[model samples]
Target chain A: MHPLAPVTAVGRSTLSMLAAIGRVTIFLGATLTHLVRPPFYPREFLSALLSIGWFSLPVVGLTTLFTGGALALQIYAGGARFNAEAVVPQIVAIGMVRELGPVLTGLMVAGRVAASIAAEVGTMKVTEQIDALVTLSTNPMKYLTVPRVLAATLALPLLAAVGNVIGILGGYLVGTTRLDFNAAVYLTNTVDFLEAADVVSGLVKAAVFGFIVALMGCYHGMNSGRGAQGVGRATTNAVVSSSILILASNYLLTEVFFSA
Target chain B: MIAMQDVHKAFGPKKVLRGVTLDVARGESLVIIGGSGTGKSVTIKCILGLVTPDTGLITLDGQDVRRAERDAFLARFGMLFQGGALFDSLSVWQNVAFRLLRGALKRPRAEAREIAIEKLRRVGLTPDVADLFPAELSGGMQKRVGLARAIAAEPEIIFFDEPTTGLDPIMAGVINDLIREIVVEMGATAITITHDMSSVRAIADKVAMLHDGVIQWTGPVARMDTSGDPFVEQFIHGRAEGPIEAVR
Candidate 1:
């Protein structure tokens, strides 16, 4: 191999990564700019809210329920070593409200809403529908990205709030029925343990996660290459990128909210 | 009038349009013909500012297309895409009335629907098809719907990107004739990109052949049969062995 071959490969990959980052940054700026501008499509925003928020509740609920139950069982088992199994209710409540609730809801949405948005918009791009929108005196950023992004940003917090409630209830159920704890005491312990900061931070994380999911979907979609394969690739990229960003941001936000 | 001067475009290392130049007069139908992947679409897209050229100047009515206020400029033009490109989620009437339902040109919903129905009828589609989604319609019906949408706002310029592509021969002829009638009636400046010889005969006032990122020959449609340019002759006759090499 040539002596410079390694250097060339590394340089090329680095440039490609930088280009991708540049494209995404520019797209973020464009989306934010369009979000504040006039000519908003309320109908599109409402439809996106329905699809991204309302339709996603069942999956989010089920995921959190199972997670909360399993978390309660694990916490009880771990606490039993110290004769502290009574901490299950408080631990489960804190876990559900502070971390798992928002993070899991985000991942679920990254799977559902992100992939759907990418597929829909990528297909539209492939078929020249986006160009058609431009020809029709419509700015695609305003018509498509802004609405989806705004809807997701506004919807995920509500979804997380609902999921948090349902998750805490799941833990209560498990703590009482499965672990032989008193139901009323489990409820009181959970209520006493979770502060407003915990719940509010979770909701804040949900909002940011929502924005990431929608933004990744739109960015991948608007830049989709050219055919069925391109659209498929865009959908996969949307899910993968959004999920990674969600997990990474979860850590950072946790640091900001809870690190002491 | 629209003009493109030495427009150059490339996607990475593959050059699409290289020093391409062309012009279209007001109330004239200029049909660009070429082998697949010869930058015909890129040329039109450059004019529309959908695809920016790497280097060039494009002017419509003596003003640079990119410098014009976007909405006002786009509102003066219409486009019929190759695959119809109808918004699948919208009903046919909504697709047709897309421009009229929003932006600076917005009209009342009832009025937009009425205009959409009228345009649909003009494109030979019945009013009953107005409520059907693009996905529910046949390919031919979809193209008609796209054409209806293109003409709905009565723009001063119309672009037809392979308007008859994917249609049966009869439907292709019908669409060509419809396009011809519309262009003549509207007296709009028009640009069409297609390889179909029949589309050329039916719709072109002037025909330009694009090849290898350049306009090989352009002239009145009547002179096309005897244009004497090898590229034009080979393309019009659908010859495989010629200056134009088949990609495969």
Candidate 2:
């Protein structure tokens, strides 16, 4: 009703958003602090590693396989613009290692792992299992968040590396069988084109993305509102935010790694 | 002893606890009763430090709860939540043995399992229930397991929040009986929050009636009916017409 109502609404929304960022930053800082502190849960860490890494393999592997095959085809076709079609092996290898492999693996794991963590922890929060943990003299951050974040951070790089190999193999398979290229020559060109920097950068991106994914999931979950709808919203926010942060961090990391 | 003085807590514009004061001496069983959303649970949470008061003093054994070392302080108390709050991922024995398996109360796996089975038996659950996950248990069984967990570490103080919520009356009676027996046998200080009158009669040595974010009346259980406080009278009698206005 007031003339200044529109401005007030915008200001309120902006303030709320900033508050959310501040809270998430605090959650992240606490998680990192607890990660190094001891009375660590080796059982919880091993279990989380199994869930986030080993369980994620099939989905990450499948996504990269299909993506690598398609990337090889697209590169071959695009190269034909200048009759440079034979560059498929080189381009496919570079593209998969430098960008697509890590990004896709990150996003896939984000969707699968982040959503589960949020739903799981959100349920725990609302149902008072988290409070129960507190009453039992255990820090939920140390017990729940640290193990999960550490597992994801450590596992994603390994997952990405495996994804890189599988993806390159996919490209190799497609180039040789579907595109009628010499298998040995394609392998040599693929091997020759990808530098160590490319692989390292992608793995590093995978690690950061992994951290963002679990952090968002834990952050949203521990702060979730009371019931089923609250947990559902936390899960959605975890997946969406993690996916977006993954892409954003990927670009930023790439720039930092490759830019002069 | 646990003591609270003029405890006040608010969430946004909704003031849940205006000014609450209560006390439970060591080895006493105190039951808090109020309608839903009347801050009955908040009062218990304040004592446990699960929820901090906006303003007031809460002390346990003469130590300021806010200043107590968290692990050492928490080690003295255990709680049973309304929903059982069992970790779905953990089997029943593991849930019961949660405190024993980690942190300051760490025990070897075999010893913890033995303690878990013993506690579960104390709560009238079979040893067979130990290996099964919480999801496989019914609401009553889950409550029993939650009770088992609360006593696993044999804490000096125990709290039961809406301990009979969502269970059948027969199961509720069993839980109430178990609570009374456990409190008496362990000689642990007990605090319970509930609107259920049956729970009050079964569990309270002293009863406190909460209304409008404050303790309206508190007295020994024998004097509850004769206390003549309108809020207590209306709440205990389930009266619709009284000084205590029922929300439509």
Off by more than 4 A, model 2: A1-3
lDDT of each: 0.94, 0.93
> Can you give the DockQ of every candidate in the order shown?
0.95, 0.92
lDDT of 2 at A32: 84
Q: Residue A257 in candidate 1 has what lDDT?
A: 92
Give lDDT: candidate 1, residue B195: 89
What TM-score does candidate 2 get on C-alpha atoms?
A: 0.98
Q: Where does candidate 2 chain A have its weakest 10-residue lDDT segment?
A: A164-173
Q: Per-residue alpha-carbon lDDT of model 2 for A99-206, expressed as tens digits?
A: 988999999999999999999999999999999998888889999999999999999999999898889888888899999999999999989888999999999999
Q: Proportion of native contacts found in each model?
A: 1.00, 1.00
Off by over 4 Å in 1: A3-8
